[model samples]
Target chain A: MDRTIRVLVGKPGLDGHDRGAKVIARSFRDAGMEVIYSGLHRTPEELARMAVEEDVDVVACSILSGAHNTLLPRVVECLKKEKGTEELDVLVLAGGIIPAEDVEFLKANGVDEVFGPGTNTQDIVEYTKTNLKR
Target chain B: MFSGYPGGMVLYLHNQIIQGLCERKRAGLARAVTLVENGSEHARHILEEAYRLRGHSKVIGITGSPGVGKSTLVDSLIGAIRERGDSVGVIAVDPSSPFTGGAILGDRVRVRSRTTDNEVFFRSLASRGYLGGLSRHTGDIITLFDAFGFDYVLVETVGTGQSEVDIMRYAHSVLVVMAPGLGDDIQAIKAGILEIGDVFCVNKADHPDADRAVAVLEAMLGLNRQWQWKPPVVKTVASQGKGVVELLGKIDEHLEFLKQNGLLEERVSRSYIAALEDNIRRDTVDRILTEARLDGTLDLVLTQLSQGKTYPAAVAKQLIGKYLCAEESDNQ
Candidate 1:
């Protein structure tokens, strides 16, 4: 079977501004991937549950509320618990107003890459295409 | 139990998945739905098992135009169903881009209120080139959900226009939601949609013209002439949860009407017919086309047609004769 790339673009904080997430979701869609946008104000648990239920290949979250250090890693931890098995590999990505200093901290946790505000959409697309774990 | 290398592995996985599904594990149900959505070879086995175990859940289809609050209404309905101590599964469909075959499934955003509730399972699907406002495998997925032992299954179609009435073939009750001030009063008079609605809801009832929209829909419903079960039009502001209970009550009444009148069986049989026809098309037309493309016959036909050498109907007849009839005769 020809598998289509499935990505979950989620906002895990109280950030009501979802413009960045919407843009990335659309970019993924235009690149021929199926994107599940988890609206807004999603907790880490909810996002993790959605990723597991949707069986997506990637979990690309956008957070602008400056809670990346606290929330992004929780998303990864919750996803691991939700899957309950390591057979399904998921690529975790973060994008938003994340700072350069915090990128290493996020990667140390579980995030594979971080795209800043001005990062090109195509670059993110390529990054996802190349870094997909499945 | 084909003990061959990969076939054995596949069989093992399938058996494990089916066991989990029978035991009401959400992970198993989720994986089974993915297999069906992806049209995997093992999907046939899963669906066969699902058919044997289904028929407990009520399948409801909610459809409307863009920005009609279908998703919000569905969220409210999920809460209502759960309050009554019943489990529900939701399938929300969005359209895919025709050029790129990509889709952004945002319905989950509006319907994520019940994400923490294990009894409420939600899945999003892209239409994936199916133009009738639904995914191709919607029926199969619904079967999987039903077999997982949910009390209710809600299938929300992509924002629809006139003539996306395929929902009627699969759903026992169809809820047609409309908002006020979208010039939908004229839309209520259209023939295709007016005939398929089992219950009509005028959402965004907080708007000033909400009552007027309700009036228009009722007037249209009155023109049906015969009245075995007249579809009731209820006003709701789905975002605020206003009038949602009444709407759900009306939907339940429709289901009750179907059961009492022996019409539920008819609807089930209609779904069967639709599923049969869909499989036939996939097995015949889609298979032939795929084989033709692989063997370069499609390219040859296109070249011939461009040169005015053959017509479309003649080409179709010839391909069917070559691929379908010849195989039957050879088997004989």
Candidate 2:
């Protein structure tokens, strides 16, 4: 059976803010993908294990506590170490409170994309589609 | 002699009953639905078996503010559908207590008396304080009916604002029932319900200001036609069954239009994809949270972060490193 692309949407760390995560989840739903939100305050390890177990094609983490720099690298490392040999094909993305310069820096260290506040939901949906395995 | 497994007789009996349901038996389907709605474990197994056999029912969801006469409106339309020789399945969702998870499904009183008629199947669901203001299990029940070969399945919900609007995702066509006095209520819900409806109904059209409400809806539609799908508005006095025939006609018309225009196929395929993805995601996340032991540490992390004792950024990095990448050995 050709499985649908599964995505894990997690708000890692102390970010109590979930409105953005929810909107993003809805956007994905509207775009016809399954989104599992890790609810609020998921640890990066928790998200990584979930991605592997759920066999998700993508892991999109939303962070607003100014933790993109600290959290992004660890998420990437987790995906590579635990799931790499299988070539499980995971794409890591981040959104919320990200500065412009950090986008490039995070992308260099394995973050595929960074969306700031006020980013249209359409853009997020497009990004997800583009990143999924054909 | 009893089977070795516990509850074996119950399962065996339920299977016999559900087998009759698969053969298009009404007694079995009705009894099965009642059992599931009551949350019986045996009913679940029967429903699962029945679901595998049923297919090809168009599920329609109708929701609106209380007193909009949704039940009366649906009751009237049921006759029209029956006249057309199509078997109909109706599921009405009513409010239940958020605390005790208790509900009173009173609308069944109106629908049950007509049970002797094989053309109609009526079932009511208890919303039971689910976040979306509809029963969590309502979708599954609809699926069971779909498998049973009903031509159309109707889901009625007690309106509770934005979340109830989510029902449109599960419907081939969504009818947002409104009344004459509820323009302000419409304004309140416009954010959620307005965008999703395929057809809008102004029930209680016999009232003095019915036209005024219709006019308001017309203006609302004028602003909303920018989407790929533009919903149409209809007026009805549901209590008296006035306009119900016309309403059914409109539904048929829309169904034809949607099918010919290719909108129906697009909608069903899109919703199916979305639902499939959601299920995978939910199952995946649950596995990680449960098996990776993240659930145990999650509370402590939250407490520390909330108390300002830990930096969220640093904590996030550590989580991915320890739990996610530790298997790699090098990363750890």
TM-score of predicted model 2?
0.59
Over the stretch B9-49, how does candidate 2's per-residue lDDT look in tens digits? Answer: 67576765677567765446655654555456676567657
Question: Evaluated with DockQ, which candidate comes out highest?
Answer: 1
The CAPRI quality class of candidate 2 comes to incorrect
Alpha-carbon runs more than 4 Å astray in model 2: A1-134, B1-14, B30-54, B110-113, B184-189, B225-230, B277-299, B310-332
Candidate 1 local lDDT, B188-261, one digit each (tens):
67678667889999999999999998898888888888889999999998888999889889999999999999
- lDDT minimum window of 10 residues, candidate 2 chain A: A1-10
Q: How close is candidate 1 to the true structure, as a TM-score?
A: 0.95
Q: Which residues of candidate 1, in runs, are more than 4 Å off? A: A86-88, B1-7, B184-186, B329-332
Chain A (alone) TM-scores for all candidate structures:
0.96, 0.91
DockQ scores for all the models shown?
Answer: 0.80, 0.01
